[model samples]
Target: MDLVITILVLLLVVALSGAVVRILPIRLPLPLLQIATGALLARPFGLHVEFDPGLFFLLFIPPLLFADGWRIPKRELFLLRGPILALAVGLVFFTIVGVGYFVHWLIPTVPLAVAFALAAVLSPTDAVAVTSITGHATIPPRLMHVLSGEALLNDASGLVALQFAVAAELTGHFSLTTAAGDFALTALGGVAAGVFVSAAFGVVRRRLVRWSSEVDPASQVSLLLLMPFAAYLLAEHFGVSGILAAVAAGMTVNFTDVSKGGYVATRVQSVAVWSMVEFTFNGLIFVLLGMQLPGIVGNAKLDLAQAGGGELWYLAAYVAAITLALIVLRFVWVWLSLRFVLMRALHRGEQRPKVGTRLMWTAALAGVRGAITLAGVLSIPLMKAEDVPFPTRDLMIFLATGVILATLLIGAIGLPLSAKKLKLPGEDPRVKEERMARALSAEAALRGIAEEQKRVEETRDEKAIALASRVAARVVGDYQQRLEAAGEEGDVPEKARAEAGTERIMRLAALRAERRELFDLRRSHRINDETLRALIRELDLAEASLTGLHAE
Candidate 1:
């Protein structure tokens, strides 16, 4: 009961924090604010929550990665492949090697393997942090794609490296060749598993859609939600990278309406359901992070003081040094790589443009770490072989926490300032592309209506045909207006758009009134719950369409 109550309270806090952040005059990053709120609620309030490392990985990561893969702009991802790979794979290994040595040299008490383990923990940037910061910001699509793609793939690489390092520590040995071979096999195997799982699920979903009369949207949504966990667990069971498996599963599922009759309700309901889950899960993770601070700090203090009174200062200095190194190294690598490696390849035939210094800085500042890093560090076993406490475990947690805070601070302050200073492209080309696509779709819809009108005319019943043609003409007129409004040429007038928006609101109010009447009827026993639900679903779909059309 206490545990359940604690979870409810934490969720309430998450909800309230989201509302509060939105109403603030100066918009702050949501994840950072949640972290601060969690920290505050931990002490004085005496809110204590324990999160198991294994459960944390299982419950939180798969869905987050899956959603990222599902939503990532595939076209942009392909175009930015070179830089994404350079950062995701190349920079990750570089950090593990470079920072691993740096940490080992700084703290002689910590083993080289443990140092590498810490590096691996910090290597992958957090996708949640990147999206939270850049979601509203006017950044280039290519840059956002690179950051997102890197976050998705690097989780697998970083975790694999961490596993090898831990294995080396336990055995008191290390092998470069074996580790490299295992890493390649794990990545490839994970991708294959994910593809297989996704394809299987895709067939099932399509079959269910074909049998729509026997299945409801709720059941379909429930099944869709299980996909990520299934892929992750299956890959893990096969001794492969679960993170990559989840990501690939998300990417492989065909969410678009390519089939003759796509599952509209399923798609719509699944998006809403997943979005809510993502919000709650992400919020809880950051809040849990704050709750862990008191214990982490206490452990670090005791461990460092036991080493020597002066060693506390050394620990602090190391944290600062590592945090600074992460920032500096990322900037240098991005700048140098883009100018030399990527540019040369692009000149040969790649479609990407040469990355400039401004974009490089943007990417560097965007390298913020969050929940994943904390989870990795905290997952370090408390005891290793012979029941001895894991070497530097406390210190590693402390350092990881410090790095997370440092990067968040840097990102929150630097991202906006750099974006402003650089005058990075504020306009998203995708917005224009979406508008054009909608216009084309509306034109096609009009043509379909015209064909229906022609068919009705062939019935040759004057009265019935006249009524049908009038309705068709009205629908065609609406589509024609929408098609003209979303013209491909020049910008629409702000006043006209605002008026159209106002008109939409008026129409929505009328729909809502109708919905209220239907609910009232159900409450009064004039209609059954089943019928009410069916009618409500229609209203929900209408509202969803209106909301989507207006979303920019």
Candidate 2:
């Protein structure tokens, strides 16, 4: 009963945070607001959650990582692969070493292994949290893409590093060569497991769905929700990287969506459902952090007192120092990386634009940490052995939490300022690409219509042939106008193009009105729920046809 009430309250809090964020006069990031709300809940209202580290990890990490993998723009990911790889893989190792040593040096009592674990948790950037902070603030498109790709890949890499660091601490031994081999084996096995499970599920679902002629959209969404969890569990069962498996499973979702286009209802509902899940899960993470904030501070102080370490001021210094080190380390790496690329370009006689210092700074400051960092810190072992609590576990978690907060503040306050004056093309370049695609699709549609009309003329009765000809002419006219509206074909009249735009707007407006009426009809008992749904679906499809053509 308590568990159920806690969950309900958390969900309510998540929902209320969204509402509260909107009403506040001063704009604040949702995560920050959620954290504050959680603190209020804990201190005054006495909200406390029993957090099992393993359960916390399993419940939160897989789906979030999978969503990152799925949502990462694949085209940008491929284009920015070089820089993304540098940040995600190279920077992770660099942070693990540099930050690990700094952490150990800063506090000698904290073992190197524990420091490394903390550093590893801090390495992965949370682009989603950065997005909330940056909030459509005209950052360069390429930089945003690189940030996103880095977040996607480094979640697996950072967590994997933490896993190894934990193992080293457990056994009191470490070997580079053995760790490398094991890492390779686990990564490969994780990939294989994710691919195998996702592929098998896709094949089975497609066949069953087709055999049934129509499956419930709800059931399809439920299966999709289960997939990442399945992959994570399977990979863990085989003693491999569950993190990688979850990420791979997410990436596979892009390919699996190919045959699903015919199921418009499923597509629409699934997107809505998944978006809500992602938002809720992310909110809960910060809220949970807020809930535990008081205990985390008080407990850390007690532990420090017992160990004769310093006062609470030392904790502040440690967080500040660690956060500064991260920023500096990131700036150095990004600057060197850009310099290397530019030098290489010059040697190759290429004329690439000179990199800006602000871009580098923006990149450095964009390393915000959110849900994955929280998960990694929480996943730290609760005990070293039987009845022995892990050393500095709370302190490390506290430090990590401090970094997460510091980075979020920097991202909220600094990133926009860094990007504000940049005079790059700055427009979303996809408009032109979308136009070109529309024109090409229009040409193909005209050809298909012409071919079908010819076949109908030869193979049908006179009345049927006449109907087919009229239908072809109407559709061909629509496609041709679509091409003209895209402004991709030969000189089209300005008046005709203006008419096309107006026509699309009016059609969409009408469709929306029609959908609302259908819902109202069902509400007023003039129509059944099935009738309402059918009408709404048709309107939705029609609206979809017009939605993206204007690139709006």
Off by over 4 Å in 2: 257-261, 488-500, 519-524, 540-552
Candidate 2 structure quality by residue, lDDT tens digits, 464-485: 8999988888888888887777
Per-residue alpha-carbon lDDT of model 1 for 343-366, expressed as tens digits? Answer: 676788877655567777888888
TM-score for all models, in order of appearance = 0.89, 0.94
Off by over 4 Å in 1: 24-26, 134-136, 207-212, 255-262, 306-315, 341-355, 424-427, 490-499, 512-540, 550-552
- Best of the candidates, TM-score: 2
Worst 10 residues of 2 by lDDT: 488-497
Q: Backbone collision count in every prediction?
A: 0, 0
TM-score of 2: 0.94
lDDT of candidate 1 vs native? Answer: 0.80
